[model samples]
Target chain A: MRSMYKSSLIACIVLISVLASYSFAMAAKKVELVVWDLQGYSDQQWYKNANKAFMEKHPNIKLEFEPHEGVPARPKFISAVRTGNAPDVGILNLYWVKDFAMNGWIQPLDPLIEPETRADFFDGFLDYASYDGKLYGLFTETGVATVLYRKDLFAEAGINPPKLLEAWDFEEFAEAAKKLTKDVDGDGKIDIWGIGISGSRTGGGGPTTFTQFPFFWALGGELIDEDGWPAFNSEAGLASLQLYHDLVYKHGVSPRESYSYTWDDIARGFSAGQYAMALLHNTHAPNMDKQFPGQVGAMLYPVPEHGITSATTAGGWIYSILTDDPAKQQAAWEYVSWMLSPEVMKSMCADIGGLPTRRSVFDDTMFASDWNQVFGRQLEGAHMKPGDPIFPLIQDEFAVAIQEVMMNQKDPATALDDAERNVVQRAKATDILK
Target chain B: MERKSGSLKQGWPYILMILPTFLLLGLVTFYPALYNIWLSFRNESLRTTVSSFVGLANYRRVLSDPFFWGALGRTVIYMIASLVLRVVLGLALALVLNIPQRGRSVARTAILLPWVLSEIIVTAMWLWILDHRTGLLNGLLATVKLGPYGWLVYPGMAMGTIVMVSLWKNLAFSFLLLFAALQQIPLDLYDSGKIDGCSSGGLIRYITLPLIRPTVTIVTIMVSISAFGQFSLVYSLTGGGPLRSTELVGLYMYQQAFNFLDIGYGAAIAMVIFLINIALSLVYYYALRSESLY
Candidate 1:
């Protein structure tokens, strides 16, 4: 009996040792991955849900989410990188990835991503986050600048409706815009404008450039030439500026009051039925669908010719890893890869009704609406802003000319020439024309 | 506790009390101003990793830029315009409120509402009202055959609208101070002026304005400093735009610092603005040295 009791006690001792070691191993496996993003208010729930689902799947990794806005957020991240305390992973605008990569603040994800994973995302977006053949990020939320128009208004005016299958030429588009403009109140003032173009230089130069760059592209103008010099003084640029001016002054489709509007104001005005057509991003699809229901129409930007080369600017957030710790790098890759996967992306894009960066994610049918399908197809033709590290500063300098021309303060040629000169001087000062 | 020995020892507790206050002020205000001054003499930009001592090159660059001088000119104009409007409107409101009229408490409370809210909030409220289309002001204008004017778009009108909004936000403080000053002035002065065959306007010129001279100087200095540093309102409202018609020096410094990413040049602009504010304050201080309120 005493021998039996001794064996049982020995077994209890063995069980306690094994249990303690297992608990220690589990404790050592705890990995805390910090992520910063600019998801906005509407998309916060997706991040929260992703965090819970990711943690449950891994059961050893804790995801810490810090959401921020765009303008103020970029500088904060830059400052963190300067201080050597940036988050393990974060989302930044694709334009900023160039500058961050130039400064060597963010690490290249090329070495981290596998071949199959790399094949999952579109090459058009992958090129945006690449600097000198090193892929630095994978775009998560993508947007394509496109024309949002009124289907009901087109019907009421008996216009050949714009379609994703065939975009309207500039001449036809201008004529249609003139017909849609109306003074329904008989007050001698136009109540409904034909187009919503943001003419304000408010909130920096971004709003003016994002909405107007497509028109410049269609007019055969380039913001910067192949040699990385300001080429906005070309005849095509003058024509594009003239087009913007004529919309306000000659065509009378846009109002003089629009000079006070920002991009936000333009969006609000479009929603308030102030404009029959507006240039907006694919990110605006869900809101447009909800507000105007089946009455809203989507189309690629009208080109100078109906079927010739068309262009739309693509911009949005890309997930970048900022840490040098290999363990943390692996953990961050897991989070980023999971976030960019087809299943997770389909869930997020469906929840927010946002444009997906990966082609495989769109096959889920949640984004199979006509509007979504159109914007999704346009992603193949969309490209990043010309490869310049100082593109934001360039955009700012160029906006003065756009504002001057649109406000009728200066003619297009003089304004474009002056803007190009200013850009040249600034580029020389910064010493980074490329 | 026992009695302290030397004068310095006796003042130890008082010094300890004020020490934290000084440290807080140094951390919050003086340190940043000095650091900015130090930065103004260096070459600091995002493109360069190491900042080198440039010795007034940043200042030279900013001073030579035409945008800087234009912004400075507008800032001076903005300060003077805002100062004039605030004093005049504040004095008028103070005089009216000090008359002991009906609903006087309600009026006093309502007068302080604009000043109590933050400048950004007030600017947003004003932006909605002053928007060119579908604004309260424009809607009211439409009732008549009047304008749905671009009040915040036209150059001169944008600056004027900013000044008006600044006045609306800051007038209450001046009004309260002037009102307090008015109360301290015995009613006997006004009665005596009346007894001596003085007109109401005459009484105000000699008795009221003279008595409020010191308070007006304080009000001018306070309002001028606040207006000189106005950043958020213009940053949010007009973005100093319509071709920078309303670009204050503060907004110029921000665009230089962050947008242009040249911290040295931005610091130079700030130091210049700071020096100008000090000179203006000194001038006002000497100009309004009151000669006995009696």
Candidate 2:
């Protein structure tokens, strides 16, 4: 009996030792987290430093970074998710959050993130990254549309540019544009245009919508109504379209070639002194300033007469996790948290000349500049693109309407009507609207 | 049955030798084609989780859409215009290059530069050259006191400008094929024509034209097929924009498939494009078929 009891005790000890060793080995095992980032991240110093620090902090988690260009990355990411070959994490345009979440291509980060961490993000950004009350991702940086104008041209024209937080009414803005347009050479040709707008259909008319939606919204235009139907063909919508048309044809202040301009074209043209003013994203403010010191200024978009309020569109990239494995999910969450932390966010935004999504990052000195403050104030009233999966189709139609009206192919009312009809048809067909 | 079995047994080695290629083609080419056709019959979209069989719905949608028809019309116009310019200019340049002259080799290489360039690079270069406000062409025109024109911005000019650029890029392709055919023509025939007091034009009309007729037909079919399916150039340059003035069928199909995530409808459009391509090839083959030379 004594020998048998001794044997049982030894056996129990052996089993416990075996289980503890197994658990330790599993805990120490390296988990490789694959991350797909927009192309050029590999070359950015901030990105490299963040990766180095992340790996140093989490020695057991290995990160595999794959760089892909934005244009081709969308379809490639979708294809990867469908084929079960998706990376552990991916950085996507904030507009894709709803679509991706709805399709179950990305997992919600709410479970992985703490409430305090979630609350640190700006309300607009959190809303942009959420769908159906679940937080799907966190924004990396933020962009808001503002009027980037030439300060020198404004001074030369004897027109005072609007203050940082101030805005111009439609009439004042149009008058200033007209005054700034000049034929300096006196060759019977206007050498410098007053303003430039992007009406290109690229990105499903993303540039047009991004820069022009503010005007529409300033007049109380709602892109998607309470009933989840497109309502951009209302009175406010017509007025906004007319404003764009008049700027080009009636006022003759904007270039007719605005119909083909992309966002980059507007930025480059503004830097080259082709236009006195340009309605562009504030992200271009830093680069423009760097190229031409103290020559560029930014302000809130102009409002129409009796306009409800001034508004601008906000957009940015969001980091999302696509993995189903718990270990990989945890690692991805750690990476996202580290990236979104105030220290990292501030450094990255400063390096890239972008606005940080976290509210705490605004406390930094870099964002206290007058130009940055202009964008920072605009963020207060900025609108995000609707999160509906069918919004892309609606945006495309809106692009067509903008082009048609600006090019004089159709009147404002008719253009809006046509676009509304198309959006409705597409929405109903997709079952997004009944 | 025994005789067939015997033949199969005799042919087994050849079949074994070609089996890998057949398998690869079946996997890569035939499978995707069949799957795309299958996808056309269903209501498949990236946005939706459930894919149900909705036979003929996608096809009906594509067929009834006015935009599809408009894009088709534009594509046809683009194809015809580019094809004509490519053929006429290709023949002219090939003739010029065929003449033995100083730096003829250098000239041929320089002419082939555009053809060898990637479509995206070519589009980017032309976009810079044709930009309305900051284009090299407009800048040059300004120096001469000429007016700056909206080469790519105007709806009326966008399609024509794209065609012109397309011609510049692809002229070398047709030129090379015709030039190769010119090289193969018998020198004796041309010499005889010359001895018979034939002018240069007469010699080319009789000997060169007839001898290169077959190659021209092949080049036409090839260029037509390429022009019909053009996507990267137009998509990158104009994005079928300026009020859909340059929206070709391929770009429309791409927008529906990738942009809108309506894969089923895009597949239907793709199938239609494939059928059109096959029909075009057949028409060109039969209409331009050459008789055998003795």
Best by DockQ: 2
- Candidate 1 chain A has its poorest 10 consecutive residues by lDDT at A425-434
lDDT of 1 at A223: 71
For model 1, what fraction of the real interface contacts is kept? 0.50
- Best-fitting candidate, measured by TM-score? 2
Local error of candidate 1 at residue A232 (angstroms): 2.3
Q: Provide chain B TM-scores across all predictions.
A: 0.93, 0.92
Candidate 1's DockQ is 0.56
Enumerate the candidates' DockQ scores in order. Answer: 0.56, 0.68
Which runs of model 2 end up more than 4 angstroms from their true locations?
A: A305-308, B1-19, B194-202, B292-294
Best by lDDT: 2
Identify the CAPRI category of the predicted complex in candidate 1.
medium
Q: Which DockQ-derived CAPRI band holds candidate 2?
A: medium
Give the RMSD in angstroms, all C-alphas superposed, for model 2.
Answer: 2.2
Give the per-residue lDDT of model 2 (tens digit) for A118-174.
888888788777888998999899888989888888888899987667888999999
Error of 2 at A39 (Å): 1.6
Off by over 4 Å in 1: A1-29, A39-43, A429-434, B1-5, B188-199, B291-294
Candidate 1 Cα lDDT to native = 0.81
